[model samples]
Target chain A: MSQPIDKQRRAFLATASGAAAATAVAPGVFLHAVAEAAPRDSAVSDSVRYGMLIDTSKCAEGCTDCVSACDRENGLDMLLKPEGASDQHWDMQRPRWIRQVKLKNNLTGRVTALPMMCQHCEHPPCVDVCPTGASFRRADGIVMVDRHTCIGCRYCMMACPYNARSFIHESVRLKPTATPRGKGCVESCNFCVHRLDNGGTTTACQDACQHGAIVFGDLRDPNSAVSKALAQYPSEQIRADLKLNTGVRYTDI
Target chain B: MSKIHYREWGIESPRYWGLLAVLAAIVALGGFATLYMEHEGHWVTGMTNQVVWGTPHVFAIFLIVAASGALNVASIGSVFGQKMYKPLARLSGLMAITLLVGGLIVLVLDLGQPARLIVAMTTYNFKSIFAWNIYLYVGFLAIVAVYLFTMMERKANRYSHGVGVLAFVWRLILTTGTGSIFGFIVARQGYDAAIMAPMFIIMSFAYGMALYLLVLMFTFNTDERPLGDMVVRRLKNLLGVFVAAIFYFTLVYHLTNLYGTENHAYEAFILRDGGVYTWVFWLGWVLLGMVVPMGILFHPALGAQRGAITIAALLVVLGGLSAIYVIVIGGQAFPMSMFPGYTVIESGYYDGVDGMARAYSPSLPEFLLGLGGIALALLATFVAVRLLQFLPTSLADEVVDPHLAK
Candidate 1:
């Protein structure tokens, strides 16, 4: 149950990076950029590396508590609904850090609710393509972007196959709330950094996921629901063939 | 034996001061707008989640493609046996370099973080086509600068002919790479078409000729140096061929998209049923950008009229720029969904994707940034010609010494 120190450090760096970078997400968080799950240090044993198992079938209808809580906790100043013309800044134009997607299968004629957030992919194209080394994914499988180092070229926007990154475009007249919005940078979903720091398992979507549709835990551990869900039920990843090795997975209704 | 005194090769009296003044005023205003955009966030442009990359990108790409095309005459005259094109050679070279620089400036200004543009280059994203494009474009611009510089060198011990030729060859590859950026994306409905890259190349040549013709007219008005009819005809023919090729590509691209089993949502909206963009693609692009211009130039009779030729060139340039605008802007204007049935907003009023999503309209600030790029281009052109002697000062040098090898 042990490994080399360097490997451990790398794991810590990866998750920390993912969390850090996710902290900078602009256009409401997207599920992307999380590397493999592994134990970083032994003292952190029984850490129960947490994640959410989102049952798309029964996510709450329109209560965006998860989304708003995430914004409030992260200090993202997101909007469920923008106030006026100038109030709409690129970072949180319509802050649904955790929002339910109403997916309708064209062929099957079946509809389902799927809560979308940062997938924290194992092979994140955003991280791979980040020119400034600004984008990073964690060992615990979380994705994040560092706003301080982010020069804002937005190549990441184009690189993302999932269409996640949003440019903090010139909102000159916009009087932003003292939250995290900044000009000349790219931002997107960071699975609630404050909640994570407080030893909370990604609170936004999970707590609001009233039907107990959301499961968060370490997939690497067999005891974890995420692992149990994968082991028991048929699951799917977004654009799976892309080989992004995404952390987020969905099960049937 | 004395050489044939064909014509002078420098920009003399040009009273286009009115145009310059107006543009200068606009450029200053644009600079102010740029400052504002930088100060705030991207609330200036109309781009939203639905319409991410907008008009500025289209214009940036168009200008770059046109800039690349402007190099062809140089290639033809140097690579082939077209002697008449020699007089305007330097002008075309100068314009190509200028326009390329101009395109890059606008592209950089449009970035959410302009300073971080270099980061993409330094960081390699093999999966992302855009990453490769940024690198290739920079490479293209570098080579072009060298090529233009080489051509500008004085005949005595000049060392840029080979350099210029090398740059010309690289330009083609660079443009092809640019095309692939869009062409290779199979997922995006309107973009999955592979012919997009070649179509871009052909379109560039059209823009190149259109721009060259426009430059010639400007010169004529100022009496800097009048171009011979033979040379102008070559320009016309070059444009005609390019227009025809682009038209061929466009027809095939759409027809294939429709003919195939793949249910394309984007192209279907644009080429077949979409409202405003359909007109843009069909008439503005197919009819105006391609067909009419092709008709005007392809006809032997119309080719004889310099005035008519000029008109054709004008249409070709207009249509080409518009085509890119329509493809980039209009492409996004349409809703995006791989599936159908659930009240799909099938392009009625660019009401944008998802009722919650917003539409893109280039704000005054956005427009200013775009103009600033153009101004930067003009300024670069003026400085290049002034200092490096990029313009042909003597027609004697045009034929006097082909090789600068002491």
Candidate 2:
């Protein structure tokens, strides 16, 4: 019985090899396709480093499309004030994944508009200061919080240089299917990991930008839009002096 | 040489019960405040996304650092072999444990998810300073407990020195870990300096000694125990030295920051421009906390007076709180330099537009919670002294100082 099973396996292998040869497809391309088709729950490979490059020169001064789109996508827009909280108080307390910032050069007086979020540093201080390892960086370079492990110490908020993280100040309502948020956890820009896992390449902000100022792609892929754009135009990380080597880059800051 | 005797405070006065009642009430109020804050979320507090840590951290860090410093008297007795300090060692150990528990309670209750404390304990993040602190704190508690046991039990006395030395080393590392929590953050301009660790060590020395002195005087006076001028003077001088050391460290820290051109704006904000921060630094910390306390402790007329010494100790505690406030809240109030050359004209996330500092005002609940930690520490000390033979009936010069008896 063992010999017959071995003989059958050999025959099957021969037929599979013959079919592969007939197709004449490159082995590397075939393997790449197979890897891409694998389940999302499989560990994230180091081969892909997701990054974003923002062309601030093209960003409109008053536009909040990216900010509003991120809020809608993350269900941040659906947040409600506590029973008696003032609008101003609630505004300051609410979590924001992205914000439109207008900057002006002190000396040159040149104005620039851009949307700022998590820079997703290669070495995140938030991850380092978190007592419970709740603040973590994925293998693909997206920085996120594990809600289950986050004890709401807000040490990550204290450690974050970008001021990108927000603590849920009130009980959340109508949380989106993609983002699972609650009271007493730190949340930040995840680079839309939910969208990425769902086979979407672009973030909500990138998709909503009418000026095409936001470019999101795999940094490891040299031909990817973000990589090509970064190579063509000089881009600098926010707080470059800290040497955090951020996944997000900006031009004409 | 006469054997020193230790006795439990056997006072049954209504005043004692009144004191306990007041402290318990404060703790209960603090518990209520904590539950309200936790249920309603941090929104009820003055803490914001910009100033994430507020008044509670100031009080908690002060108490935590003071807890490490409170053990200095015990270390002096056991490790340094100061015969005069031996009788006071038991109370020192008790205070150390009590203060630590009090501070930790405030810190845990302030968490976003206080109920998830078990997760914080079980999970390990070796790379994080916060995680390392958990170990340091627990280890300190255990070591100090053993040290206390060695001091109290006759058979364990021989091993006291070894355990005392271990406790000393652990404490230094513990305080260093605490300081590193702020020091390691390279992102914030105010806290990246390596001096923070040593500065916190020195600060713990000053704050802890001052608090210890006050507790020692209050307990002895209330129990009608004879506290000696010799012992009081020694502790007072020690506190003066620690306070002076704190001043020196503060000077060195600022001078180092001033040397760097990058720190100029930050230094200016703390020293001159920062509204409440500037006042708190100069007046609350520098003048009232250090200068007045130092002057009172060293004055020819005032130094010898118990009343003056008590006032000085109180001042040191106030100053310590102010200093922590400046470091924790003020450090965060200043905006991060996200764009070095460019100024933020407008931002949606209260990112300190136009180089403005983030606003923070402590709410009633925040203050109540902080006060609760203090009350808890006092209550623990009060109860322990009443139950255990941690205090001597007398610390009079003839009793504590053998040379004087001779």
Candidate 3:
């Protein structure tokens, strides 16, 4: 019985090896888009500083498409409000990865609308203040919190200038596989890191924006869309005096 | 001069047991509160993303600051060579250890992941002031423990001054590190200033001295040990100076912020129109915590009376808590100036609303948890006094005052 089973396994192995060998020689010919589907096995490179440029001129007020898309993509929408929790409290308590902000110029009285999220600063105060170093900026310039190490001290929340980060105030029953969230950890927008890691070119928010107000690309590459927009338009970093050298920039505010 | 004699708190009275039981019950309640908050997450309480830290921080920070301050007697006795303070040094050292332990317990338990405290201890982010504080806190405990031993053990008495000096320096650094936790956040208008470090140090001194006097008086009076007018006068006078220093720093801190055009809005919010925060600052911190207590301490008529001094000390402790509440909660209450020149009219997060001061009312559990910390500190001080010779047999004028004894 053992000999027969071993012989069957050998035959199966030969067939599997034959298919693998054929696919390797002509990759996508045998296995449809095999190389395209293959995950990035190497460390993320620092050569590309991923960034975004939001054109407030193009951003329409009352349009929450970017926020909705982010919620859907990150599974923030999946969280059920705890029973008996008030809507007012739930609004404040729920973790929001992106929020639509409508700002009126104090002097000009002109209104401007845009989506706000983590600026992903060069010198992130959150990272500097986090006792466990759970808050960190990726090599590719996407700032994120490592939930595994996050003690949920909330010093990062206090330190954030943009109010970009959110704490999981309640137990998370449901979350996306890509964005693993739980109670007792700080979290923020990571430029849709899962999408980027999976070889996707654009984020959920960038893709969802019909007006093309949000542009996501490598800021390090001058020819890239974000860099080109930054060069073309007079974009400014929010609180430019902070000198955070933020990866996210805005224009026509 | 007569040799100082130390003894355990051997009252064996029912009142003593009652006090311990009450503290124990509160500690148990605090434990329950922590479990409830931890199980339900912070949402069950009033804490939201907007106000991540709530009452627990107020208690923890107050206790920790007071812990550093509690060592004043020992430092005065050993380091500053105040012979009058030498008799009270042992209790001072003990109170410091207990208060810190109690405060740290509340702080660790309040964490989003209390079980992950090991990670906090093991992980080191040197640049982070919080990471440095773990060392400062732990080192404070160790250094104070050694200092206690030098004072307690007969042969080690010779090294008491050396260890006392080390403990004194470590505590100053400890308090500084604690202040730096808030001060280092450069963007927050309330805490960005470097004055916070020195301000906290001065605060610790006042808060610490108040607690020290209260404990010393209570313990001595209960046990029928005479705490002299000389010791009382010295400590109370020291407390007055500290309270006045706090006043000076408060003035300077506010004035500095007021001078800066950028900080005008924040200053206004804190000083005039921050609603509850403003009330807590002026009424709780300034009026009751400082002015009234200072009046009681410095008034020639009231200053000599033990009951009046006790009341003043209690006021100082209460005021210290108010000051900490304002610093921790009120500081976070003010919204971050995300759009410096633009008013955020609408946002999913409550930005630029309610005079830009976010709502934060301390819930029942949070309040209970904070009270539990104070009880724990007192309970430990009680137990340690009973079990060990932490108090002098007597602190009569002739016993304590070198001039009189001679």
Q: What are the RMSDs of all candidates, in order?
A: 11.2, 7.8, 4.1
Cα lDDT tens digits for candidate 3, B1-406? 4798899996657989998999999999999999999999888878888887899999999999999999988999999997878888999999999999989999988888999999999987888999999999999999999999999999999999999999999999999999998899876779898999999999999998999999888888888888789889989999999999999999999998899899999999899989998999999899999999999999999999999999999999999999999999998888878788888888878876524777777888998899899999999999999998898898889887657876
Q: What is the i-RMS of every prediction? A: 5.6, 0.8, 0.9
Q: In model 2, where do residues sit more than 4 Å from their true spots?
A: A1-38
Which sections of candidate 3 miss by over 4 Å? A1-39
Query: Candidate 1 docking category?
Result: incorrect
Preferred candidate (lDDT higher): 1 or 2: 2
lDDT of 2 by residue, B49-124 (tens): 8889999998899999999999999989888999899998999999899999999999999999999999999997
Compare the candidates by DockQ and give the number of the best one: 3
Q: List residue ranges in candidate 1 displaced over 4 A.
A: A1-52, A78-92, A105-109, A128-130, A159-163, A169-181, A193-200, A241-243, B1-19, B116-134, B154-161, B184-187, B338-358, B382-406
Two-chain DockQ for model 1:
0.20
Colliding pairs, model 2: none
lDDT of each: 0.64, 0.92, 0.90
> Number of backbone collisions per candidate, in order?
43, 0, 0
Q: What is the lDDT of residue A20 in candidate 3?
A: 89
lDDT of 3 by residue, A90-141 (tens): 7888999899889888899999998989999998999999999999988999
* Per-candidate interface DockQ score: 0.20, 0.61, 0.69
